[model samples]
Target: MKGLCTGLAAAAVFMATGCQASEPPTQVVYRFDDHRYLELKGWDCEGELWYTDTKQGVHSQIASQFYRIFTKKFVHPSERYIAIPWWGNITGGFSVSKDYGQTWETGGASMSPGENEPDGSNAPYYDDVLSFTVVNDQGFLQTKHRLYMSSKPFDDPRILPGGSGITYTASDGAVHHIKPTSSGPAWGLDYITKQGLKEDTAQFKTNYQGLPDKVPEVKGYTGWDHMRCDMGVGR
Candidate 1:
């Protein structure tokens, strides 16, 4: 019986240390700028603002500022436009800039501020507007914990189905899910969907910090121009 016990122990040891462990599932790496994220990247800090034009090799200066005050949280869907969730004040609503940053005009009153208003909505209801994205002409803005979307840019933004990791179809007829990423924007992550099989190249990690090592064949994009669509996947 003692010999039987010893043999069992030896078998257990072999099972524990004989073979290598499997690697973890490959997760997508997202790069974004959150108030907490800018520190991880290289930038010139000034007061509450951290400015950098060459973030990950992108020609854009991000003035990381506080949520309130005159600081504007803007999103540039294209080189010709810059959109903001709040124009100037809490009730200022949204705004947009067409000719670069040369000028900005109010878009609409999607968000308003007040106290104890009806409809269970008021100043603080839609406050804390953070990241904004334009997927196929449909505008989606992520707030403190909820997602508000609009059919058009700066139009009436309404709350979408709550909770993260929920899949939804965009106005462009494409499916998207706000999945986790290692890196985009200042949030250290952003939204993405399973884009189905790779056309070329075997499966590999696409971690470029912010600059792509090679320019992909994409339309309307000049090699590393700071314009990152689909995390610079070019698809």
Candidate 2:
């Protein structure tokens, strides 16, 4: 296993080569960020946010460890647009940027304080307002955790089996239960037909920290940027 991991790490380091010949318009390659690698730090899980971008003719890759709810998360279908799920306050939310790494803007309703009411007693029901997943930017998957806009807001957000993996509350915008995946950590969304709502397919491990070696020790995102749609994966 150790030898195989060493080979794979060497292979990844090689594949990660040519990730970019020249930095995109408003982008910067990791090159060397001391606090690199994915690990469970912020909140109570381990993961990272990664994204790709392409503009005019140049291409670039972006990754970061920003924390919140679904913090360390980034997916891009086209090089032009990127779907980034960043954490905010101890609470949670998201933002969008257009002009490369120039700016970012948050959206959706604003909450007063972290979980619970201002007094920390009564709490409002929360659905999957921010429970989101993207498959290379083709389509986004979200479980029905809260029914924020209906009578049954955030009723069923897909039962996240075993707390050994990554799961999401969907209501108060929380992404918990995280396991490791080959590429990174198994923190994606899995759909359940019988349940009629997207289930939190992420499974939590008993050791939790005992993750797959390939998962990488990522704490959170360090920096971020977007690529073009035409410039998909690989150069």
RMSD of each: 22.5, 20.7
**Model 1: which ten-residue window has the lowest total lDDT?**
194-203
The global C-alpha lDDT for each of the candidates, from Candidate 1 onward, is: 0.31, 0.29
Largest TM-score belongs to which candidate? 1
Give all TM-scores, in the order shown. 0.27, 0.24
lDDT of 1 by residue, 131-210 (tens): 45533333345456444333232211112223233354655688855433311121111211111102111011232112
* Tens-digit per-residue lDDT, 147-185, candidate 2: 111011111222233323345455578765433332121
State the local distance difference test value for candidate 1.
Answer: 0.31
Question: lDDT of model 2 at residue 45?
Answer: 30
